[model samples]
Target: MMPETFLSWWQFNNARGKQPDMSNKCPPVLHVPAAGEQAQRLAALSQTFISAFTQQPQFFTRAPGRVNLIGEHVDYCGYAVFPMAVEQDILVAVAINTSGRLNICNVDANFPPYSCDINNYEINKERPVWHNYILSGVRGIQDEGGMQQPFIGINMAVTGNVPPSSGLSSSSALVCASALGMAHSHGLSLSQETLAEICARCERHVGTQGGGMDQAIAFLATKDTAKLIEFNPLQATSVTLPPGATFVVANCLAPMNKAANSYFNCRVMECRLATQVMAKKAGLPWRTFQKLGDLQRALDKTLLQMITLVEDSFEVRPYSKRQVCELLNTTPDELNQVSLSENTRHIQEFKLHDRALHVFSEAHRVWEFKKVCVEGGAYALHTLGRLMQESHKSTQLLYECSHPKLDTLVELSKGLALGARLTGAGWGGCMVALVEEDKVEQYKEHLWKSYYSKEAAAEGRPRNTLLFSSPPGPGACVFVK
Candidate 1:
């Protein structure tokens, strides 16, 4: 069924000349639910928009946050990642205006209100505020559409349930929802694949060098399945999760804002450096290689072989700047210019051996995870759980991304959960656990008593939000009036 979004686009394009039909490729459009909790929330959101702008909204867009069941920190390495969308999401109430200015307000008063000329706004990388994420989406669409005329300005009222900075991808969902609203406003009908790619690239404007996993899953997810999202062309394949498996996510109450610090980009740079060093050793042009996955393809080696290569090529000790420079046959300045990001350019040492090992092994774990899910059996859950445990260990020991609090949560889930691991960039965030359907309540209560109840930060927050089971939910979509 063609949603109002596509129908409106078809009507708009008919006047301007025909455009490619992308109905199947675009996000599904559905009527706003007439009753139930979603309807109530959207109804309240519509009223919030009217109260803020004194006019009815044109439409609404939603983009869900995701949980990476496995495959952590491997997307930027150009490897496939397994992630499923969650029920929590960011929703925007949007209306077009001829004022040529963007007006943005948040339902939560903490954000306050923001405005800028539609054609004149810059995303603040140094101190990115909430609206900067929305602006990033607008800017991305503007760049992609390249309209000669200024885009009709938009008024947006934003509300989200996804916990911010707790690594459930709250930031990416905002960018995607905003992007979807902007595209629909302009009568542009881009495919979901195109939108996901654009949002992924544009979110970097906020200065976090993330792999595309979050954004890819934001758009490509379906209602009841997890997706194996591959990069270098961005394809998603549905993988049925083993039956009777329930995934529970628990926030450690520690928030790591990726763009606000250097940890995330530091890891990215380390991976790049490792890939280059490996390439240089293999007689391949090191400068041309950035992702370990690319290097693996060039060498025509399996993931296991790459792990072996990592062991043989480097020591467990961190590589000093001088050591890396000498190995690459380049000076420190050249190394910084070629391989490092602005945030990671300063005095540094890199743990190349462990980082490369984590990435290669984690990539292999993703494949193993897919295999176990595809070939489900009595032992499938046990095997998948073991793979998850191994992935977490690699993230903790080798990647060095897991937080103490995150590790504590994982540790707390030891006997109750099949396996648990930190789910996002993980300098401090949330952990996802594979729990059986029958054990979900028991698992959550165990964590609450052992972890959340004692934490001062989780005080006064709803227990369900802090600890809940998240099945694979639907991808991003639009709800039109």
Candidate 2:
């Protein structure tokens, strides 16, 4: 019955031309391929699942990794982000088991198999366990009251192509796939928006203060189109790219795990503190404002106005803990208790000014980028490219998240690509570049000789693993036979 219902939903969605509403009753369907590359991939994955678990998979859930085209580090600021799903994604092949336990294995032997009772399990936060991501989704659904019926155990074989810790959103992809798998296994129905919100909140259990761009894109992205993902209401509007434009993603080969360290959370805390400080200076209830966008709304000011306020209210230098407490009119103890995150409470200084500056500037760039995309012309691509370049500069200088290797990549790509920038939380991840369609091969070859080839030769490593040319791909879906 569950398999038939899932297939019926998939057939219904496909019959409707692939555009579905966000109603609560209708479950989101996965891509059902008739005959093509996707069909081949699905067949191969199904075979692997059967070989590993010794049973045919009921259904497969897929969630794509994303690349931020223009908006960087602004999603949590309550600003719109420009991101599109990439070809790389996580695929989970699942079958129900009556054993009342989740038996999970990864196709890559590097990740060990994990097993536990489906209804009772804990996520290990201190260690970077691979299966903990799946557990996060399961726990998310359980907490969201999706387990009204008796818990159904599952056998899952997970596999993915998204590079880990390279800022292409591999972790979020896994979590989204797991959430979808759990929903299907239990015969649960969920809208894309509901699942996106749930997955975003539950991923916090992994200890990364993420802004929901990855999860949103994973759930909402459409084929060959970028999304203007706005927060507060959590809606996505499709933004078509310019004609004959190509985007290339190049990994700097440095992995920055947001959960393993406090850098990502530290930035989040700084932005939160900045908003509170600004609200206090304006004589509003500072504690009520957690995001920079909220403060802007409260003041009814434009992005430029908010930039001015940041310049006027905060100094360029780092603000000491004492200074922040004094500005907010609170004690250090009270500040730690109320304002700071668990990981950032021990830090003594904050870069409030720089963080605020970056948020406001980046938010403005996002709108400008959308405008150029909407009004496509001969120079539209160039204008968008220039905005991306400026965005990278702000992330590098003001936000201080860009790594030296990323900077080197951007600099080296200056002549080859129209514009290049770090696409994620920065600090050693992948950089996305806007290149013309004809120049894509040329750009890749140039990068190979200049960056990948030289680095591989010098370090005695492989060159092909570091770079990729990504086209926009579809969002989350279940693949059925």
Candidate 3:
């Protein structure tokens, strides 16, 4: 089918709009095949759904994974992040069921089938099951007070190309697809912005205190452009990348599950404590501030100014529980109750200096990265590459989130790409490299030979699955027959 003829039978006018447009102002609809490769992908997923459920699905919902190009770990700090939707995505085929229970299946046999009553459901936080991400989205909608009728049941078969625990946001994509499927199954209408915010809050049920960058980009992304995703209203502005540059996402073959461990939450707690301490030092209602970005705004200081303030206020040595309690003028119990997360309450030493310095400096790099992308010049690529390298360094030294494998990959990728940095929440995820379009082949070959080949020779495994290149793709959408 041609692009214009795709999803022509959906009749979107009755729901929201007639078609998807360049401005991305309309609700996400699959009127056109997302680029060339997704056409075959949609067809295969449709067939899989029919075979799995023994019924033709009414429609399909898609949510793409995102790669943070420059910004790292600052989204929860309330700073803007630069990210783009990857072509790899989660696609779900949905069919209405009268059984009053939601049935979910995955094409990958590793994840088993899951089913629960739509009206009565509970998310498991003690041990986060994979399907809880879907449940969280459904619960989010149920918590929203404006629904006219209760949500109906659905039979969903899902397929995804994005690798799990690789820092490409496979979980968030699943949550976004589930939210879209739940809303559509219930005959409910939600704007893209509303859905993004709801899904963002909903993922918190899985026990990660993340900002809205993943869901916002998953819903608001446009083709061929990275988005400058901002919070405190949740807006997305498209950013055209410099020409002849390609983003290559390389996996170190190491997986890090953020929900299962406290490494991710530890950084979050440190940032929160750092914010409150900085606010208390500045005498700006420290109790009201929770994020580093909020403190920056309250102090009316530039990003550089924030860095200076961090140096002046915080010591290089780690702060003990007693020291923090004294600084905040509270007891250890009170500090634990108010400042720390459930997983981080036992942490006695907090790296206030390093975490605060990373947040301020990294936030500054995001703005500079955007400026280079917006105002293209002869040295734009070089300048942008330097910023990315600096970001990786700060994430390594200051945030202390980089794994040994990630550091080795970054070191091996030098001279072949403009810059390489660990993306996502760090601690052994994927690293995104900015490579010239023409040099991507050489870059891949070099990485394969330098890193993957050595590992394969040592362990007797395949080398080809470790790396690939992707472009900015569309966000969440619905495909109707």
Candidate 4:
């Protein structure tokens, strides 16, 4: 096999410049289903190959995009969320050498080089913070004995076609790629469990604390299908996209300010408080309430009571709708004479309009959406669109994770991209879009004028915005793609 570096051999064969007859944009020699591309006519132009490229056959890995079908903000809140790996992702071509060196070059010109070595892989080093995601993965693997003793130096190059920070889990895609490369080169077979755990730790390298959704999706998903992944004890099940219509996604171009100290943490704290309040009322620890009916009843009662007291009950907060015991530490029995009508109003307001409702409903919506997607029923696209809108509404009105800029972008996208909503962690993160095929160009044009143009004028040429369509690709793969 001549060391089986897939690309090296493919390029060697392709060097004769033999033209591929078919119109498929993919190369004649490569049949990687994970690539999620299949236009037999090679898509990469001759310009792409002018510069020499190397693929170390010793290691190969792929990671996919994580799309939160529903339950966007509930992941970090200990709430069940539904997300799936889309067809798009990052593929890493890695090779090990005795050169005692680590170097990385991205296929796209957008990001810079990622180079580091065993000795210098310190905790939270600053110079190449951008590559920290991958570095962290490598370090985690090494920490867990996934690395070999001889310091298996690597010359790795990455090709990232995935849009950055559009909330598609690009960072996770890269982390998994690095982990696979490291594990393969070091002769380690990391079970999915270990891989997910390693990925969680590696993600912190990006300087953003994230749940394991991105990494898990990249590692576990299958082609042409979405996976409903659960974090606790780690479970994965497929959720199929409807056949006829493609769910389109657009980049709102607005970025999240997750780096801020209090923003992400405060939401986390709030969710914790909600769970604790529910647990206390139920006379159980915060962990139980596995059934939907049980969870719904508790949340509904808790919130409806708070909503009832909103108007006349000065003790109840219009926003949080907490009882005196919740806020002022008063006992529930002490308020036995409290106006039931007023208290009920407050609880209703909280249940319907408060963030608690969003968490519970969004959590529940995941199951609903999964069932609809799996059964292949005639679920209208409008209905799907409405669910997406509701998901965003919950994120915004209830959860308060959405940003003003994102809301504006969503408003702007309404006339163009069919459905537009926040994609990632909300609070100033990326938004998703569902554009019809022919309307894609029109949508992008409108988006450019509306977002990038103004941004460029204000800030001297903003980054490039990508628009792509990919079918569900293989979860993660080696030379088989």
Candidate 5:
């Protein structure tokens, strides 16, 4: 039976003045395209179900997918980053629930029902041992606020197009969506700082330790521009782009599951170790050296100084993204005594390795990256792109993070007269390519004919080289229908 058609609030969220109960300020907005939306309409139209389920329409909120233009792997250390929102975002429409629980539904047929009892959720150092990023946001809201701030149940339906683990900050989008949805539902006010903290901590519930880069921009980004996220001091700015210049990001459906190798955590530990070695050499506390850029300065001084202080301490193993794929030959669940954190110590590398050199310099590149974008300098962007390719060489050569197939895509991207870099933690994931808008068509064709479709013909793989533009999508905001 064709489902009844109630007003599609989410579909119309972007319509001017369509958002309900919003004040004069440019409130954060969301748009959710979901199958659960149909379910809601069906339930509303069906007399018996509407009466039985209880009907209370409420506000919808959303957060967008994020691509870190620069400053990868820096957020966890509290470094500033540059990120923008895209047109794609997760939309959440929430209503108050007397039952006092977070009820969630999605349009995606594959998405299962997700629910949590608000009364029972916890946000302590070790709690909510689940993948519910929103639960952590809820915990943050409660913990960060006073008891005088009461809580309310949320009846919600969420849906978005961003793929999970695609290095697009999809999870952060969900966290931001839920945060603002709940905030609006209960008439609460929040700032970017508060929202970012909530989202970052919530991510930890799922066993990932990350800084707040994704959450911050998803929560705070404005429209059609870039934002620079600063780390040494936590500040953000919306930057205007040079005329006729756009950032083109291509997503390869070749989503390598980063979780398998704890790729994110391993890198974090490596950074910690690198800092410790640098600290001893500097005769200062590890915490004193603020940015990764600082460590590079110390390392450049002399090899004797580094060798004495960072001998075994500078550990770089083959635990990179490519190595993870090779290691996948073993079944993760079947293995006993498998500790990523423990074996992490195994993959440590020498501090003086070229990859470390790339990493050490990459920290500085992020800042230079911002300068090019902000200065509207063509030479600067291209110059930065050269550094990016250099960075890729480091990841592929020094860090050993590239797969033959992955490297092919980078080569393919470069062949199309574009500048490219291996994005995310590397391995078999997609790379970020900056192509002129005019050249996008040629780039797409080259990628497919060269690699994606070739994989299809040989192994019957689905389309792999997916391409899109990166928009400065906003964080969690509410929309009413």
Candidate 6:
């Protein structure tokens, strides 16, 4: 079914004028060609599955990667995020197997085939090999179904073009796709929201300690409309883009895998520590607060007031671990148990002021961006653009996640794009720019010549996929042939 079908189904099942209710339902089943542009790709993947397993696939699952339009790093803070699903996604073809072994292969030859007993497999956090993402999903479903329950084995062939480690949620997409396949193969019926939440928790098995933005957008996004995804009961509301405004994603050609290092989690811990300190200051149970959003709510303060509180509370200097322990009135061991992840326990210092500043401010920008979209006018594009630029500045300066290449891309877009910001978990990945529809081609041309054309990484890379305009695409779904 097309996205119109999703909308129509929503209309059919509910009273008029209410928002589309997509909860408590399985992903809509569609025919192969209903997948549109990727029909041929799905067909080829299905053929590969047949040859590998000697049986036709019972079904296929697709989960799209998302580009965060404005909100960044706030999802884990329990704030809302605005993101749209891209056409690029992870596609899995699955068939039941009788051998009681889970066989996994990739359409891309770089990944070697692997098999394991479905009931006995471990996700590797040490190396985070490509298949481990899929394994994260398998483990998620197995746990969800209860380990004591028997599960039939499955053969899965995977393929994706979301640019791994490019901050586009490719890893999360794989996890969602695998979990969806596993759930369906086992006669389990799960909603998109349930699967998304499960995949989000399970992905931590790979050691990223990420928030749920990636997985939530992957499952809940709708076609042609960006979604404002709120956590703690994950809900999605569609936001329409203003007319004549185009969003383009360009690769910085630098990739950072969140699981391969501690940079990502370090920021997560910084936010956590900031929240606890503030909670304690506010006379709330510090241990109960793990997110800045939750802390803000407990205080019943607006985002602006939270920003002010951060300024009043934390010194600008980086807080050494010892200093942090002293402020919290706890020993390093107790502090570690309360605030730090395993990967971040070794960290020496935390920039509580800057990280808190960024999260609170960026969380505010998400709402502003949505407001500009909701109240579209002659100045809506420019207003939204300005908010995006501000977001980039905070991410670069305060969060310290932006890479030199990403900064350079934003610098290059100063005039050509209305606004541009590093889109993903930033150490290196892609930057999203907002451009007038008429200026999009010129913007791409300028970026290619000034940026990609001069880099060795771009020497043989395809320009179309590397730099492209993206509208919101549909969420995860299953295809029945």
Q: lDDT of each model, Cα atoms only?
A: 0.90, 0.86, 0.85, 0.58, 0.57, 0.89
Q: What tens-digit string does per-residue lDDT give for candidate 1 at 1-481?
A: 2344654564576448533244878988878889987788898888889998887887899999999999999999999999999999999999876567899988898998999998898888998688889988998898884455678778999999999998999999999999998887776778889999999999989998888999999999999999999998999999999998799999999989988989999999999999999999999999999999999999999999999999999998999988999899999889989999998999579999999999999999999999999989999988988999999999999999999999999899889899999999998989999998898888888898888888999999999788888779998888976
lDDT of 1 at 221: 95
How good is model 1 by TM-score? Answer: 0.95
- For model 1, where is the 10-residue window of minimal lDDT? 13-22
User: For model 1, what is the error of residue 137's alpha carbon versus the real structure, in angstroms, after optimal superposition?
Assistant: 0.9
For residues 1-481, could you state the per-residue lDDT of candidate 6 as single tens digits? 5534643453354334332233446677677775556887888898788878777777799999989999899999999999999989999998766677899988888888899998888777888799999989998998874435677678999989899888899999999999988876665667888888999999999998888999998988899999999988899999999999899999999989989999999999999999999888888888888999989888999999999999999999899999888877889999888889988899999999999999999999999999999999999999998999999999999999999999999999999899999998999999999999999999999999999989998998899768998889999988878
Best-performing candidate as measured by TM-score: 1
User: In candidate 3, what are the lDDT values of residues 265-323, reduced to their tens digit?
Assistant: 89989999999998888887777889998888888999999999999998898999899
Every model: Cα RMSD to truth:
3.5, 4.2, 4.7, 10.1, 8.8, 6.4
Instruction: Write model 5 residue lDDT over 22-129, tens digit each, in one string.
Output: 442335543433457534543332332223236544556667887666655656644456677776667655665656677666655476556677757654433332
lDDT (tens digit, per residue) of candidate 4 on 125-209: 3343446767777777777734446455676666665666567877778878787667655556566656776777666654554
Give the runs in model 5 whose Cα sits over 4 Å from its true position: 1-56, 122-131, 147-150, 257-261, 286-356, 398-404, 457-465
TM-score of each: 0.95, 0.92, 0.92, 0.69, 0.74, 0.94
Better of 1 and 3 by lDDT: 1
Quote the lDDT for 19 in model 4.
24
**Count of backbone collisions in candidate 4:** 33
Please tell me which model should have the higher lDDT, number 3 or number 4.
Answer: 3
The weakest ten consecutive residues by lDDT in model 4 span 38-47
**How many residue pairs clash in all the candidates, one count each?**
0, 2, 0, 33, 27, 0
Best by lDDT: 1
